[model samples]
Target chain A: MSNTLTPVLSGRADSPRLAWVLKRPELGVGGLAVVAMVVIGSINPAFWDAANLFSLLRANVITGILALGVMIVMLSGGIDVSFPAFAIAAMYLTIKGMIALGYDGVVLPFAVATMIGLLLGLINGLFVYGLRMIPLIVTLGTGTAVRGLLLGAVGSSQINIDRMPPALIGFGRLEFLRSVGGGNGLSTMVVLYAALAVMVHLMLRHTLIGRSIFALGGSEEAARRAGFNVRTTIFFIYGMAGALAGCTGLLHGSMIWVANPRDMVGIELDVIAAVVLGGTSIFGGRGSVMGTMLGVFTLVLLTNSLIIMHIDTTWQRIVTGSIVILAAAATSWRDRRIAA
Target chain B: MTATPARRMLALRPRRVDPALVQMAALAVVVFILMASLNPQRFLRPYVFDSITYMAPELGLLSIAMMLTMLSGGIDLSVIGLANLAGILAGLFFHATAGASGPDLRHAGAAVLCGGIGIAVTAGIVGGAINGLLITRARVTPILATIGSGQIFTGIALVLTGGPAIVGFPGAWSAIGNGRVLGVAAPLVIFIVIAGTIGGLLTRTPFGLSLKLIGTNTRAATFSGLRTGRTVLLSYILSGTLAATAGILLSARTNAAKSDYGISYLLQAVLIAVLGGTNPAGGRGSVWGVTLALFALMLLSSGLQLMRFSNFLVDFIWGAFLLLSIALNALRQRRR
Candidate 1:
């Protein structure tokens, strides 16, 4: 009865083409995203317009970057909820530092922000490795503490668009594929996202450290036995994640031309949902860059195009939550099949 | 080496002290002293105690709910979302039934009050069932499932309320939040009764034993023929129910229901539950421990507030306290 009820779970790939598609790993999410785009586009022709497509891409760029960082951590069998806080702190402090020094250069500011993020990530890595507590709890505590301290002892005020560094704003304005009819061209952020995604994909596929991350996530003790220096890998993943988050935060602020301390609140769930939807296992030791990028695209389209499709904006959360559940269920079913 | 003073002292004491009790007592004394030294007149007043009694119950209930799931090797991140949704639904019930003047349940009669409670509790049960099914049947990871469910709950609340708070609960309902029983605050009384009842259930019931066994070792529990799935489901249902109770208290106290009410309470609940000695990895926790931890945090927060500390600083302290307590617990486990 249950087998009949769950056809997707019970059915095996009957054809060579179907089996090949399934084995590629990335095709599943990529195909789902294409289908979603077509459906949404058909429902609302406006969704296919260059402006709307650009807006969708804009919304995804920051979250996509953050999700990449989270994907790396998840790949290493750890959960991090602290990146948002670190990102904001790094962005805000970098701006404040620039203002205080009366300096307005893009390169130095981004470098400083990345360094700050790396430092915060190292702290999380320290606690997770040293205290040997669960990553979720450790990150939760650190995230809260970092946010609170930033608001309390540091500054709670927002850096408005006018007060933003001109150089950084100019950097954000650099774009390509300038559309006709006065439409805003795609920002340089898309290029950055693509480059970063490709870089992460290559690193994960080619590097020894990347393999160590997978091994650590698969089984910590086993990784240790294999002489992978599990501690270094743990530190490396978190630090890398933090650095990316920090850079993305500043990128977000520059694009929007403001740094609000409260921005990025409650984004952990959305990014995590997207990553897992992309086929990254919450239990770790599985996932891919292509899958995660496609997953983010699907999520961004669904959320951004709700208005165009005549759905209530509030329904976005419901749909996203359902996606998370369905994705996790699919992952669980697949894991069981492999085990069997 | 055998005749050392420390060894002799250890030999002299047959029973070890409960760390939860010690932590609770030490926290109380420290907070009391600190507050007294800072502002003796203001801190020692009945008004301050009254305020703390009123504020702690909702958070206290949520912490207990969090503890229950943790004890079963799971967690309920949906507590806050479930809580707000429950409150909003109950408020909507009263809003729809009450004549154009708005719901003033004080004179609306006993049946109306019962209806509100019933609505909230049923929502809790339904929400908990969803979480349970996702975890046990769908086999989604507990955290991921709860996170998703929490989002759904909050979204529903947002859709229902249209981003604004639902006001006008029955006056009688507010009385439950604000009224006193023999000079004690009503919320405190309710908290005590529920806490005591849960404490009894955990110690005296088969379900409780099975939950702990499952947490401690799932394979062993299955070998022993324990109903692991049912126990996990009950844990979530009970967690949801407790969260609903907190929701009722929140609406009654504030006289309104919103989608984002008590959002910060989620973190605090997790922190308090863990500080109360509920292991994050599961298999061990006590109602008494959680109760003590609740009081300790309440007093500590109250003391900090009395000192005119900013809310941000308070949040920082709570996070620090959680980290410190976890570190201490880890060290203690290492020693064992």
Candidate 2:
């Protein structure tokens, strides 16, 4: 029996492919999210209502965008705790700068906001790569600094958009897909999120840089030995995260029509949780854009259901926290079981 | 010639003392300079001491709890949630037993002693056990597992109280939290004793050494026959207990227990642990370093408050300090 097991374990090609898919691991979380959505929708008719569905997707857009950036960082075997602060900072600065300069036109402000985001990302990248500092520490520091900058810039006042240039507000309200009944539709942001998700999926799965990311995450030393520039990979990953965060900031500004320094406070935890729940390993080296999308959806649905049920916001936080923990636990247990 | 060679060798050898202690010393010097420069006259006053003393108890206890888990190479993100829940539970128990009509001395005493200490400790241990079982046995990571448990516990607290605060505890309980005992607040006394006990245990006891071994090198520790799982589990239990104790103290001090009581302490506790030189990756740290770090943090916050900074500013400062300390520590390690 021992001899037979050894042969199978070391078998040349046939069995290894099966083992690879089993170990990819995120498939389980993705499956679970689908099951949860189906079960919940079956139980509550309102869950399937087109208006509610669109609204749910809309609510998750900001988190989804944030999670996309986080997924990139996580895949690079690093964590970024500063994305939320960066987002808030980007939003405040972009709004205030646009207002201060009287560039009320939509396109110019958008580009400037994105450029600010890219610069912020570049700073984070430099700190993590050039300085050889830990991502967690570097990002945490930047997160704080960014938040402080926002507070100092905006003071204590919330900057409201009174008559935003049609194009900017249009991004949030523009419907891309109208339902057959004509009572509900998908907004431009949701389409953007889906397209971005697809793009990230392709980048992670198909591109050479994407493979290098996986390699770096799997083992930095090995990746370096394989002729990959580990520092460059890390820098780009963090930059991608920052850029996505910037996009989310713009989305947030458009949706709320206000930029408050304190808005989306403590949202990093949610982003991390969503990424983890989506089946990305906290230690990195593994992730999936699709799984993360499902995770965002699951969380948004959970929060919406809680609201519909009239649960307090505090309890909702507790529940969301618990679900995140349980999801990570379940994934871990499954991984161990497969290993055995 | 032999003596001179030996002296050279001694001078070349690297220091083996705890980095955390050294960091704490550096932080203290920085604080001292700041205090002297900012407001020398008021800084030395008893009122400042009073403020520092008042802030120490719960935060100190929280830092110690965070230190234990971190030393074991794990994190307890749920400490804040547990503390909040425990505080709320203690408040509810105190109010129920003591009656809302007025301060019932006997009932209040029972609540503080039994309700606060007994129930809180038990709950904390159970919470820790749950986290341990999930992480060690079920293979869940520390952050996710504890976070999940934290959520459940917080939810339970909210459900128990219907999301409102539990207030109107007997004045005696508040007195115990607020009163001076031997020239220090009672919570401060408790904090000192607990810190001393924890410090002694980590340095002097076999269990402590086992924790260090596990934290430093899990595989090696396991190979050496240390019960790694059990040791990790015990650390979580200790963390949970301390968090719960902090919760009870907070409830006693405020004469109310709200769900938000411990929410703010999460970042602060982790910051104290890291700033005091506790490695985020785990293994090397000191109890004294954590205690001193707590004091430094408290002083910083108090000073910032006095300067009329917003809560957001204080939060940003804490986040910055945490990041800076860890990054500096990493740089130091790389040089070594």
Candidate 3:
């Protein structure tokens, strides 16, 4: 709207009252999520069951990780729809490599796949920073390229897994929250998600680099004048996103126990919806990892409840889409009102 | 003496250049040459022309819709979804009135077909109005608003038929989609007429001029007393209607309507529009440029299929090409 190629991701941090409200958007959204849960649980007692929560957490694993990655990108005043492609490509290549190379080892395969993902993200960073292109277009192009590569080359042979790397299977089955869910416990993947969330939360709150990211999102010129290396910060943001995507891909493949090529193709929308709905401003500098965490849970819970209610799955998209728009509109409107 | 004569000849000649036109012409040449070399047999045939003509209209129309929206500094992500919903609605009408699995649907007559077409177009227009309302009235960003509406439309479509294809149109409906007028597919003819009319609207009409002004600077336009909101709303309505028409054509030709019809078209439409040189930031584009882009892509894709290349391969090329061209476009802007 302002003639800036990147439509502002976050709101300005200068407004005292507005910034306070913006920074604390999660409280409102989180409350709504709780309300929805209570209402839905009353409607269907099964919705409150531990099994449902366990499965919901499992489903949230991929989206939760993706939200963390997207939060970083969005905070930096950019968007990355390319991460699903990154994850898919990374996982596909890893799966293919395992079969073709017969690598029984855990660390090597994942390391190679993640490096590839990082490389892909670096490409996005270069296009956005060096070429000075819009982040959406840069990532869109790269994302499509990665998807094309996956479909063109390794996509034809979807390998069914008879055996997984010892590490993956071990990671998948390990139970956390042993006291909950009727002995099924919380999944290892969900546990991993919590750990990652804490790590990201700390990074965003305490670290100088994290603070600079917010500054950059608020305004690049100001960030530059404040002595932040804008390009390096952006590059790192995209790279970090890519690395996270790769990790998620491995987890996905492990959970399914099959290297299905078509997996995670259109899931970017869900991830984005979750993050944005969680109260992350599309125009950056106002959001939190914890908020994103709540957003992911909100989405998962909504979808789960709909299924339990026997509502057509098609309605999920409608709801998700509406939530995204309403969240964004409310934020934008509030920001405008505050600015005025 | 020879050098003097050569220098004189070079200096005497006048130079003329139109960069946009030159770029478009060059793209056409490149696509033609690639196609001709790769699958000379089929591409060299007259039938291939018909095939290209047949496929071009639906895609071409969607691109025009996107281009128009982008020209106004907005986007309509809901077009494909809207189109499908419109088609599905039409299908429901025909199915209820005439019955499914009917014999020789062509004999269902022009009146019935006209009604079906009208419903689709009207639904499209209505959908567009909603999108416009959301943006202008609600203050939602174009992208997010359209996306939300798109989801709603898709949900409705699925609910209408429960995620199944709606079949059973009269045989005559296919004639409109597949038949020829002066050896040209009717859809192609419709496309040309639509393109010509819209082209005129953008360049010749006051509405078009005002829309452009609005896109270039909304605040300034508003200050000048232009009804910026109304203009945006009309642009979206036009887009929605066009997408609906495309949907009608698609369903008529395929003889079915489904929620997933042209599912891949959303991104492809945007790609083609951008490739046509519609400025994503808005306030710059040309109908001829978009038309040429449509032609080039049609050729490249059709040719690749003729050569037995996988669908994924073409997608790859398109993505890279869009990226490359955008990069080049930016570089050129920098140079200027």
Candidate 4:
């Protein structure tokens, strides 16, 4: 785990296979995903259909982006349940603002949503740092307040497709590699998620701020002693999370063509599970963008395949929860063995 | 000059009175006064009091359950889900024995009531044990573990109900929810007994002492030869039992059970637990503090309802209250 946290300039000069397997824990999740995909595809011919594949990829868009954000926060040893609230608030509010301003441009709406999210995330950073309270409690407080305020004071009504901005909806509907009759094509969201994943990966691996976040997660005291501005870094991490959530929320609403105040309820646990499943340590200071994305992919595949296999959709929650418990237990058992 | 007065007050401060409980007591009084003044006729009526007592027990039990977990340096986010699952299972029990059809409760005997309630209690025990095993034996983080189990519990409930409220409990069964014991709500009486028993368990037992020690410092407790794992596991089981009792009460009150009933109670329970001075980081809380906080919030919300405030506004206030209390606790600790 410690080796994974630090940058590895050179590979271990031991028997390459075992060393490589041990070094990249995320490969396990990827392998599991592949196996599950193959088993499901074999069981159900529809699983390999382009339409099914595109829809599954589409389903992963918002959640995958959220998982990437959460991966960053978890790397800093904080758990945030408030991102979903902030995401919906940003999305609903942004759409409402666009409607009021009679503005329909895609880029501006996204920028405004991102800014709103950044502001909300900064507030979380402030509370967590200023109050010196647990992240879970603080975020719970803010999340509830924001959700309450959004639904109560702002407006609880759904902004349906009838009222949505035309350009924004158009952007959401954009796709590449379309069939002649437009029966199957990849959603623009897939591209958006991929691009964001790459950007996050580069930022986390190649930037000083990203290193500081890892250091902070490893040990706040150590990071402080090592000349890191822990406060700014904390603020940056939360701000980034919020910004991503905000951006993703608007994208989600645009893709669905509806901005419901109650959208994205109960997504916190799922996103957290995905990030954890991806080989990110729940304790923080050990995660990667690729791992988090793979985690999301695996989770999306597992749940989506349940439907393809003619299983009850309600079983999805039970399956996801079981996976979370099993994964966490496995991680703990492995860590204990190492300690011994 | 201000520092001198503050220092003098601190010197005179007695170690016996808990400031958090006292604060809650004062807040309760203030809220009572404000509500009374705002609508003397409506707020001071027996009907309002009866309704408050009626509604407070389930949430009150939940807060107590949450407080117990917090006292041991952990939390159980699954209580609400566990409660719903318990209720659904018990509801299924009534459907099985008494029959689910309308006005056909001929088999609604004392035996049936007991059986239904027993089933709910058993569900709680099993659910709590799973959570306990996960946190203790499997070494999963309490929050993550509970979150996962909560989903599983809710999912099971959903599968059983298939997306609709299960109605038709025996008249006697629902009487527990709506019936009065000597002019007091039955649920209120049940709440008092359970809260009192749990309070006594926490204050006057070796188990309580062990819990406090563990929460304050688990390593020290472990070194001192305390059974930390066993104690935590027991606490979770107890928490689950309490939540299940609340579930039965809820089902009885509504005369129906559903997978997603009382969804908002989860956060409200957390709010009440924290407001009651249960430290989220673990250790240092009380059943009495929780009861007082519950009364205060109930009074505040009831009053606000009289003033035509929406439920969402009440939620916002609850969240604000949680944050404010956390900040106050931080300030108090810093001062010490």
DockQ of each: 0.69, 0.47, 0.50, 0.66
Give the C-alpha miss distance for residue A336 in model 3, angstroms.
Answer: 1.6
lDDT of 1 by residue, A46-69 (tens): 777786777788788999999999
lDDT of 3 by residue, B47-161 (tens): 7777888888988899899889988888888898888998899888877767776563546767878888889999999999988988898887787678778877887898898
Q: Against the native chain B, what TM-score does each candidate's chain B reach? A: 0.93, 0.91, 0.92, 0.94
Highest TM-score, which number? 1
Q: Rate the local accuracy (lDDT) of all candidates.
A: 0.86, 0.75, 0.80, 0.87
Highest DockQ model number: 1
Clashing residue pairs, backbone N/CA/C < 3 A, model 1: B105-B170, B106-B171
Q: Name the candidate, 2 or 4, with the larger TM-score value.
A: 4
- State in Å the error of residue A333, model 2: 3.0
Clashes by residue pair, model 2: none
Could you give the DockQ of candidate 4? 0.66
How do the predictions measure up, each by TM-score? 0.95, 0.90, 0.92, 0.94
Per-residue lDDT of B108-214 in model 2, one digit per residue for the tens? 56435565567777888888888888889877878768767877787788888887888776666676678888777788888888899998888778777777767
lDDT of 4 at A183: 81
Q: What are the iRMS values of all candidates?
A: 0.8, 2.9, 1.6, 1.0
Looking at model 3, residue B24 earns an lDDT score of 72
Candidate 3 lDDT over residue span A1-340, tens digit each: 1112122335455646445654566766777787888889888889777877888889889899989999999888788978998988888888777767767656777787788788888888988887777677677778887787779866756656665565665656777776778877878778789999999999889998899889988998999999999888988899989989987888788877777766786677778778877777767787889889988988888876897887878788778777777777776765565566
Question: Candidate 1, TM-score vs. the true structure?
Answer: 0.95
Scanning candidate 2 chain A in windows of ten residues, the lowest lDDT window is: A1-10
In model 4, how well does chain A match by TM-score? 0.93
Compose the digit string of candidate 2's lDDT tens values, residues A1-340. 1211233345433366545654554555556556667877777767777778778888888899899989888888787878888887777787777667666666666666667777788788887777666576577667776787567546757876673444566666777568642666777788788898899899889998898888987888899999998877877788788888887887788877777767887677777778877778766677788878878777777767775665566577676777677667655654554456
